[model samples]
Target: MTSSPLSPTETLASARRTLRTEISALQALDDRLDASFHSAVQKILSCQGKVVVTGIGKSGHIGRKIAATLASTGTPAFFMHGVEAIHGDLGMLTAQDVVMAISYSGAAQELMTVLSVCKRMAIPIIAITGHPGSELAANADIHLNVHVDHEACPLNLAPTASTTATMALGDAIAVACLEARGFQAEDFALSHPGGALGRRLLTHVRDVMRSGEALPVVRESTPIPQALQEMSRKGMGMTIVINETRAPVGIFTDGDLRRLISREGDIRQLTVADGMSHNPKHVSANALAVEAATLMDTNHLTQVVVVDDHGLLIGALHMHDLMAAKVI
Candidate 1:
C-alpha cells in the first residue's frame, strides 16, 4: 500500500535523522576499533598475492568499492562475487592471497562455502561483519566488527546505518594500509592517469613546453622589430633572447614592447637586449608543469623559458600552453 507523502519539513527531518543515525554508527565503529584492525592490516601487508574482496547483495556493492579503493591506494585488490566462488570461481584464490569477505550478518551461505574452500587452500580470510560472534567471523583468521545499534530505515529492516558503518570500516582499513605502504600522490596518480591529480603530477615541462621550431628565439643583438615578429609568429606573447651559446640572457614580451614604445617612441634603432628583461625566469625541462605554473603565477609572468642543466634554452612555455594543458 502507498503511504502518504511526507511534508517538506518532515522530509527534511527524516533526512537529518538518517544522516545522524549513520554518523553515530560510524562513531561507534571508530571507538570499537582495536588490535583486530591492526592484525587485518598486517595480514594484508604481508600477503604475497592480491586481496580478493567478496560479498553478496548490498554488501557486495560495498565490497566492490572497498576493493577499488584498496587497489587505487597501492594495495593490490579486486572484487569477487561470493555466489560465484562456490559455483567454480574459487579457482581465483591462491594460498598466497588474502580474502576479505563482507557479510553484514556474518552468515551468508555463499561466504561460508568460500570460507571452507579458503580453509582447505590455506588462504587467509579477513571477515567484516556486524556480528562478531557469528560463525563466519569465528572461523576467519581476522574479523572486523561493523556492528550498528540501529538502522536509518524507519522499520530498521533495510541495510542503512549498518552499511554506512561497514563502508567506513572498509575505508579506514584501506587508508591505514595506504599509509603503511607510504603511498603518495605520485603513486596514486600512476593508478589514476586520466584524473586531475595525474595531470598535475605526471605532466612535465618537456611534455607541455614548446620546443624546437615552435620556440620563438632571437639573438640578444636582434632588432626589437625582429623579436616582435618572432613572438607574433610563434604566438607565445614573448621571445627568448639568447646569447652566443643559445643560453637565455633575457626575455622580450609584448608588454615590454608596449612600455618601450611608451617610453621611447623612436625605438627603430633599438636591439632586443636594450628593451628585454635581463636574467629571465627559467625552469628545467624535467620540472612538473604544475611547478612551472606556480612560478609563472608567482612572478606575474605571461611566459617562461625552459632550459637544460647547462642553462641552454631548450624550449619555452606560455601561460596559454598551461591553460591548454589544464595544468594551471
Candidate 2:
C-alpha cells in the first residue's frame, strides 16, 4: 500500500509534537522522583564491586552508554548483555557487584534468566523499567520507574521518551555515586589522561614550566642589551628581572622592547630595571597549568614567571607551553 507524503507544514507540526511529548514525559519523570532514586544511588555507592548494566535490544544500547558514563565518573561499571549472562557470561558477576537491569517492560526473558543468578549470588539489583509491578521490578532491591504515558514515536511503539528518561535517571545515579565517593577532578583526570580536561586537571606549573638555564633571567640592573641576549638564548621572548636575593622584581617582554624602540628610548643607556614592568603577574610552581593560562590571558601576557613560596623565581612558562601540553 502506498502512503501519502506529509506537507512541509505537517512535517514541522509532527516534529514539534514529538518534541513536546518527550519534554512532557521528562517532566513527568522528574515529578515522580522520590525515595527510590536515592535508594538506587545508595545501593550503587555501597557496592564493593563494579556495576554490571544488563539489558536486551534497544534497552541494551542505552545500558551500554549508562555503564560507560558510570565508569568514566568514578563508578566502576561494565555492560553485560542480558542473554550473554545466561550463556556463561554470568561468571563475570561477584557477590559484591551490583546489577543495574534495564527493560521497558521489565519482563525480558533474558533479563529474567540473569536476575535469578544475581539473587542467588546475593548481588543487589537496581531495576530501570516502566512497569513497577513487573517481575523484574518486584524482585529488584531498588526500582527506578522510567514510565512514560506515551513514546515520542507517532505510533507510541518505539522506545523514545522512555529511553531518554531511563538514561537521565542513570546519569543522576552515577553523579550521586560520584559525589558520595568524594570523586575529585584530579581523580577523573587520571582515568582520562589523553583528553584535554585530563591535561588541565593533571598538569602543574612545575611540570610544564621552563627551569634552570631554559628560564630567561637577568639581574635587576643588567643592561637592556644583556637582557636581550638572555631572551634570545632562551627563545622565550621575555626575561625575568631578579633582585639581589634572586627574587623576581619585574619582567620585560619583546613587546616592551618594541615600545621602547618606538618611543626612541636610548637602548644603550637603559638598564633591565628601567625597561621592565614592575610587579608582573606570577604563579606558584605548584599551581595548575590551566590556572597559569588563565592568569596569562587575564593579564594579556604571553608568559608568566613561576615563583616559589619565598618569592624567588623558580621557572617560567610561555602560553605556547600550555597549548602544547593541551592544558588550554
Residue by residue across 139-243, what tens digits does model 1's lDDT show? Answer: 999999999989999899999999899888889999999999999999999999888999999999999999989999999889987787898899988888889
Best by TM-score: 1
Q: Spell out the clash pairs found in candidate 2.
A: none
Cα lDDT of model 2 by residue, 174-249, tens digit: 8888899899988899889889878888899999999997989888789889899999999999999888898988
Please give the range of 10 consecutive residues that has the lowest summed lDDT in model 2.
260-269
In model 1, the runs with Cα more than 4 Å from the true position are none
Give candidate 2's whole-model lDDT: 0.91
lDDT of each: 0.93, 0.91
